[model samples]
Target: MSFDYDLFVIGGGSGGVRAARLAAAEAGARVGLAEEYRMGGTCVIRGCVPKKLMVFASGYSGAFEDARAYGWGVQAGGFDWDIFKGKLEAELTRLEGIYTANLKKAGVEIHAARATLSDAHRVKLSTGEEFTAKHILVATGGRPFVPEFPGHELAITSNEMFKLDQLPKRLLIVGGGFIACEFACIMNGLGVEVTQFYRGAQVLRGFDDEARGHVADLMRDRGVNLHVGTDVISMEKTAEGIAVKSSTGHDASYDAVMYATGRVPNSDGLGLEEAGVRLGRRGEVIVDAYSQTSVPSIYAVGDVTDRINLTPVAIREGAAFVETVFHGRPTSPDHELVASAVFTQPELGAVGLTEEQAREREPIEVYSAAFRPMQTLFAGRDDRVLMKLIVSQATRKVLGCHIVADHAGELIQLAAVAIKMGATKEDFDRTVAVHPTMAEELVTMKSPTRTA
Candidate 1:
């Protein structure tokens, strides 16, 4: 049966865009995509790109101190939020342009408006336009979730955090997740009086236990007023600032408060249910292994599907979807052994199971090392880095690798390649160590720290 297009993608996010581009450019199929907001979605627009730049800007303060310790006579200056924000906005605009250009070049029709399913193979856009397609794809992604409470409207999420006119002198961050921890470190480094509140006993709840503890210690050492096992009871605006009352019986005032509690899939009001598509309890699109929804003609990917939630994973899922439906390859995006990084002060890079998870599954051996790197040692800083490997005893394969240090993100990417290839402890052992490197410890450790 002929339709307006071969595919109509509901969201122009990383996943949707990739699928549209591939379907049109490679598969010779007519494709169209619509996005309610910006083209680059969360990562390029408000999430990873901008946040990583801020992380870099914030690190210079410590770099200047270390330079002074190295006899470079460096004088640190206060951070200028306005200048950085201006440049950041421009960068996002440039990136959005690239996304649009790429889609156009690939011959995908782009609609800069909201699109929702009218039927299994039909889509209606907010622009008062309707179209029918052979298949539909949803990749609307997710948004930061803020819990309801007193004065909640006054608090901002990560979306608004990027667009703040000025940095707060005393910023109160709420949550125990990576977003909360990363911002706490970023604001502290930029010289903001940063305070963090997490109701949990510790931050980074799902990560390796020892690594999370190490990060908490270093964050406190760097002057973040982190309060675990605590939460905001209420908040109110006053002439002075935001007055906050906490569960721990502490009352304080802050210039601003930010919430990074969690994120929810953007699957609401999309006409999915009305169109006969199933949604999970969290309002996530229910899809099969190949990202096909219960309705055969409808499919979903990325955060909207609530699977693996990372940008790269979404792009992979999109590509796999195209191969499965358009190219007749029947591909399913691999979700196992996927590496991830938390961009906290001392970043955490991890691939595969955590120590807690590995031990529960099988007998395992854990190799761990923590030490002050040479650069920080010369600066007379008490900071330390951690390297840990979780190995299975039965098959002697590496079950997990976790690193806590500067550039842990970079280190983990290369390590993930090895781990993804099913590298064993002996395989790592036979490799020569990169001398005077923190990562060398990954290979040089002769014995397990402890076996479980």
Candidate 2:
């Protein structure tokens, strides 16, 4: 049966947009995309791009202090949220324009409203238009999930962080995940009296224990009031700002309460179940290796699938989907050996298996080091860096690489290349160290700290 378009993309995120573009431009197929909100989706519009910009803006405060230690005259002013926000919004607009232009250039129709599946092959948009396609790509992505609780409406998510009219004098960030830790450090650096309450033994619970501990220590040393084993019991608006009661027997008033506990897939009301497409308990679209859904004519990618959820990973999935369905290449996304970085005050970067995961499978040798970097030491700060290598003892191959330091994100990208190629401990030992560099630690650390 002939359809209105060859492919219908249900989202305008990196994944959906890329899939739509590739299907239309490269494969010479007609495509239509619908995005209820902005064109760039979470990563470009509200997630990584803006958050990284805030991270950079916040780091300037520390750089100013370091400048003084290096004998350079330094005077740092109070952070002007208005100016920064204006520029941030402009940059986001610029990125949105680029995405729009790319889609238009690729001959993909853009719909400015929400689209839901009418059936396996038909989609109805919010504007009452209906279209049928041979293939439907669902990449609707995810949203910050703030659980319902007392005075929950008073609390904001990371999505509203960039839109604040004014910087809060005191900000209460709840949760122990990467988003919580990142904003805790960010707000603190921006001169907000930041208090972080994580209702767990430690923050960044899923990361390497040693690495997270070091990061938490640095966050505290840098003036973030890090409190673990605590949670906000209730909150109400007061004259000061927001009054908060915590499970840890504490009371406080804050200008704002932000929850970064987690995110849920954007699958609700997408007509997936009605159309006979299966979803996970978390409302994530369940898909096969090639991102094909239960309904062969439909597919989902990116955070909607609850897979890798990274922007680059989504793009890869989208491209792979195009290859599989449109070009008949049957390409599957490579989800292994993927490196990622958390943009907290001392970034955490890792690739491959964690020591805990490796030890569970087989014998592993863990090489770990924590040292005060030369720059922070010169500044008379208590800052320290961590580098750990989890190696398979039997095969002598590096199973994991973890780094917690400034630019850990940048460093890990290069380290990930070696790990992806199945580089062994001997390969690292063979490489000459670049002197006067923190990255040299990745290559020079020879002995195992422990074997598990």
TM-score for all models, in order of appearance:
0.99, 0.99
Instruction: Give the per-residue lDDT digits (tens) of candidate 1, residues 307-384.
Output: 898999999999999999999999999999999999988899999899999999999999999999998999999999
Alpha-carbon local distance difference test for all models: 0.93, 0.93
Query: What digit string (tens of lDDT, one per residue) describes model 2 on residues 81-142?
Result: 99999999999999999999999999999999999999999999999999999999999999
Ten-residue segment with the worst summed lDDT in candidate 2? 205-214
Cα TM-score of candidate 2? 0.99
lDDT of 1 at 65: 89
* Model 2, residue 379: C-alpha shift (Å): 1.8
For residue 120, what is the lDDT in candidate 1?
A: 91
lDDT of 2: 0.93
Off by over 4 Å in 2: none
- Candidate 1 stretches greater than 4 Å from native: none
- Shift of residue 283 alpha carbon in model 1, Å: 0.4
